[model samples]
Target: MKKNLFRSSSLILLVILMNGCIRGYTPDVVLKKDGQPCISIPADEDFFRRQKEFNILGLDIFQTGVGELWSRHYLDSKDHYYVKNQQCLYFNYKFQTNILYDISFFSTEKGDEENRKSTKKVWMRYMRIIKKSDGTLQLLLDKEARDYY
Candidate 1:
């Protein structure tokens, strides 16, 4: 019983510390009149640290990977291990339209070596912000869309 309590406390502490590290950043959105899906990098380091870990682990660990050598790299949101994208974001669903906005970042390290460090774009999943209305919004998850959006 005590052992389980300790584990839970430790996990809670770990989560709190992590939330502290990624708190100061807010992602940017650009509205294009034409309205088609577009993927682009955040153009700075603050966004890199804000990407929420999809399931396995947070992507901020890779912040070390964005050194002088790389400009931006491709991140496939479909991979679902690192991208901060969540399918059913509810906070601002009502205010949004059908157009999707792009949120981006990448890079990292492990032990004494680089994990997914890249100087050029690599194939990764895109974190998109699609509008709730406009009928143009299509879900990659299909039926699962109703649960969230």
Candidate 2:
């Protein structure tokens, strides 16, 4: 009887540990320079595979000059933006009585020779992601231009 009880306890412990491993991992939300909550999503294989689709979606939603620039720039220099300490992309989403979603990408590098006074180069683009009634995510570029420093 004691042996059976010990086996049962061990089985239960194993199940609990396995459950944690099986669960999908979500990164923690962090604050941007502007104080908005952002959840970083790594630019892994999955993201690159869908890059074209995302750019088309952004262009279709934004339909503005700056939006066009963002779509082109993102695809061209995406690799340059990848940094170990920085997030490749981030989303800000909240669900309550109403739903709100936004996505942004930011990059900073050493300043160009022309801008010798400043030691860093920075740029950021923001867009809104809305959930359609059919449950699809739609993108919308913010009216504000990209912030550069």
Candidate 3:
């Protein structure tokens, strides 16, 4: 009985230790200096060639995928996060009840303008229009985000 208990405890301890050493916490990898999250907007080459029209209208372009992944540091523990390579575009359109679609992602009052601009480096892949009164979709910056994977 004593040997069995010791063996079980040892096995449990080894499992716990291995788990800790293996894949642990992952942080967020910020790929751009702008505060905008990266996403790939679906458009053809002509779309990019027509930057004058889109860019002037605040249209964003980019590729999609996790450029890298990392862990966010915490006081006691760490949290897993990722740097997604998706492009995001923001139009200078005002808030409209009818335009309140679910395919748009709104920007929150978090990072600064510089960070927001840096976020433009990365593009948004998809968008879920949040039903918030604010129509502004601010971007995230590169300096603000750190790359992991």
Least accurate stretch of 10 residues (summed lDDT) in model 3?
66-75
What is the C-alpha lDDT profile of model 1 across 1-149, one tens digit per residue? 56655654564355446444423233333333544323323445335665433322222211111211112322444433333332221111122333222222333321212333222121123233355466455433222322343
Error of 2 at 74 (Å): 23
Per-prediction tally of clashes: 14, 0, 49
Candidate 2: lDDT of 142?
32
Kindly list the per-residue Cα lDDT of model 2 for residues 1-149, writing each as its tens digit: 56655654564355346334323223223444443444443344134444321121011112122221223233243333333322424332232211222232322222222432222212223444444588654443334212211
Models sorted by TM-score, best on top: 2, 1, 3
Residue 120: error of model 3 in Å? 23
TM-score of each: 0.22, 0.25, 0.16
In order, candidate lDDTs are 0.31, 0.32, 0.27
Candidate 1 regions with alpha-carbon error over 4 angstroms: 1-16, 20-22, 34-41, 46-149
Q: How far is candidate 2 from the true structure (C-alpha RMSD, Å)?
A: 19.4
The CA lDDT at 138 in model 3 is 33
The candidate, 1 or 2, that scores higher on TM-score is 2
